[model samples]
Target: MREVSDAMGRPWTETGRHWWVPAVRGACAILFGILAVVWPLITLLTLVVLFGAYAIVSGAMAVYGAFRGVHPRDSRTWLAVSGVLGIAAGLIAWIWPGITALALLVLIAAYAVVVGVAEIVAAFARRRAGDTEWSHLASGVLAVIFGVLLFAWPASGALALTWLIGLFAILYGASLLLLAHRMREAGRRGAAGTAAHAV
Candidate 1:
């Protein structure tokens, strides 16, 4: 973990920038949301496939972001872990496309709980690292709450589950978008400050 954490990101890391990672995630989520809404008549099998793809893509993007940045310490490790869990969940759904809505909901709940906890821990870590420019805490809390709610009520019907999933994706996507904007703003400020000092 330490070695990986200390190692530099791939040569393409610089190209991602911090904001681009979350921006990609948010965009994917928004697209998924639009699809769900526009094609409400899609079959259950299609929904599962769409959701699996969304989870896998989201996880991949997260992993890329974690590894594609020059993060200090073990700060970004949780992000990577979250990404792994997401990928695992996605693969499970893909393999068992015939799974019931309740089962999918359970998987989603579990994923949310794990990822939410990671996000909260990462939030504190980022703050400790003097990167208190984002609102991850709120997002983390929301995720936890969403997970708990899903867990508490696993009997939700198929249509309801679909809507709930859609809502979560949209909200999560919006949050990431805001966080990315903050990251961009922070970079701009940092560059401006550096230029001022140079002048």
Candidate 2:
């Protein structure tokens, strides 16, 4: 049946072509994390500016991946939506750098939850099709948890939030790196399969 054939084929694995997208994202995250760690005692305005820059970069990457990666329409939609939200958040933060710390946290938390849910959905879709991308799943879960923590404790202040963001970025970056590697492997396997079939 077509269902069985599709399941065996695992078309979702074609994301290997865009493996570099996640790698770039991971590198940016790591760079942001390092900067955050370096300036542990930054002012509220400074934190806002830094976070805004990060959000913009992350948004741009997500948008690029949405078009660059050969994902299903649903997956692409999620990525695009997440990217738009990230850009919106970044713009808001940049425009209102004087906003209170709690306000900024709420904005970040909301953005994370929406984006995290979309990623989780996309990740699970691959799993259902037997793609088994563990790094994707882990990163989605991490994003959701981080968002929840920010939502639950808005009073954590600038210092704690900075540290939290730093840690999250590092772990998230590492997960993306793993995902990129896995994607590359998937691409190689797909190529081999194609060559074997042709032979």
Candidate 3:
């Protein structure tokens, strides 16, 4: 672990053994974001269809897991409930493809709002923990703004969601790739360090 000083000159250990993962994910997210922004309408439609498919598949899997009783009894109950909800959602979407886009937009907007609020709350909590968390605050603010904008303009939100999704996906993928790279680097470093110690 490498120790670095914070703004307050407090030593902090950089335990980022898999830094490359995030970097790759971030890069992929960026690419996806660009695609989403470029073809918002198409992306929105595709996402709706994809969501429906995913819901059905996930619901089936959940139900299977519940029946399999892989975990505790309570876990199976939760899984069953989740499966039911997923199946219901999928059925609704499949039955009303015409309205699926609008419905998805509404759901996305609601999710954004909930996530935004949570992030803001988390940022505040982090700040109170005596850590430098300006980035978290900024991110939270952006999320809130995005959510508000989506709510304010439903039509625009639908289109924007696609771009947002793409961007997020690309970034996520890039982050994963970066983390993998970083892990490899860390492993190499550790091996070298061990070799030097042996010598």
Candidate 4:
């Protein structure tokens, strides 16, 4: 919520704290959850196929990027590792398409657990730092619950992970889109207000 002064010495408030962004994100998340629940198998299969394609593309890109690096000595090791891991993942998925879905589910579950713990820790840190917003803490609690559920019954949770991941992606995308729209709107309103004040 920082305000910036224009060249004309007019102050413009930042619109980053607007509620519309979170609302839109939440709506998209709900929609994604619904879609996953409605078409679980299709979503799961599509995700596995998509991961394989991504891994191959990413591996090739990483290798190319590594070669094009200005400081080859400094970045070569990291890039090579990235390329190797990506290529290996792609090969594994290609060779065992059937196990890809299960593997993905396990990875997702592990990620959820790690992320949940991180969020919870962050919430506590923020609280200690005197941020009064309890919503962050609530979100952390929800994340932890989701992670536990994901790990508890992985076989049954595979479908659940699809729903959760889809929801998160949709929400994150919608948040970005909404924030961009809101910023544009705020700019227009600020311009109008300034013109009126000048008149």
lDDT of 3 by residue, 102-133 (tens): 56766645543544454456445434434343
Residues 126-171, model 4: lDDT tens digits: 3343333344345445545665666676476465567676665454
Candidate 2: which stretches are off by over 4 Å?
A: 1-11
Tens digit per residue, CA lDDT, model 1, 1-199: 1111123333211222477777887888777777776776767778778878888998898788677663434557998898888898889989998898778778878887887887788777766655553556666776788889888884864546666667777787788788777766656665565578799
RMSD of each: 4.9, 3.3, 9.9, 10.2
Q: Tell me model 2's lDDT, rounded to 2 decimals.
A: 0.78
- Positional deviation of 54 in candidate 2, in angstroms? 1.4
> What is the C-alpha local distance difference test score of each model?
0.71, 0.78, 0.49, 0.49
TM-score each candidate.
Answer: 0.84, 0.87, 0.47, 0.45
Give per-residue CA lDDT, model 2, range 115-160, as digits (tens): 7887898787655655666787788788899999988984967557
The C-alpha local distance difference test score for the whole of candidate 1 amounts to: 0.71
lDDT accuracy of residue 175 in candidate 4: 42
C-alpha displacement of 92 in model 4, angstroms? 11
- Model 4, residue 25: what's the lDDT? 34
Q: What would the C-alpha RMSD of candidate 2 be, to one decimal place?
A: 3.3
Stretches off by above 4 angstroms in model 4 are 1-28, 48-99, 154-157, 160-199
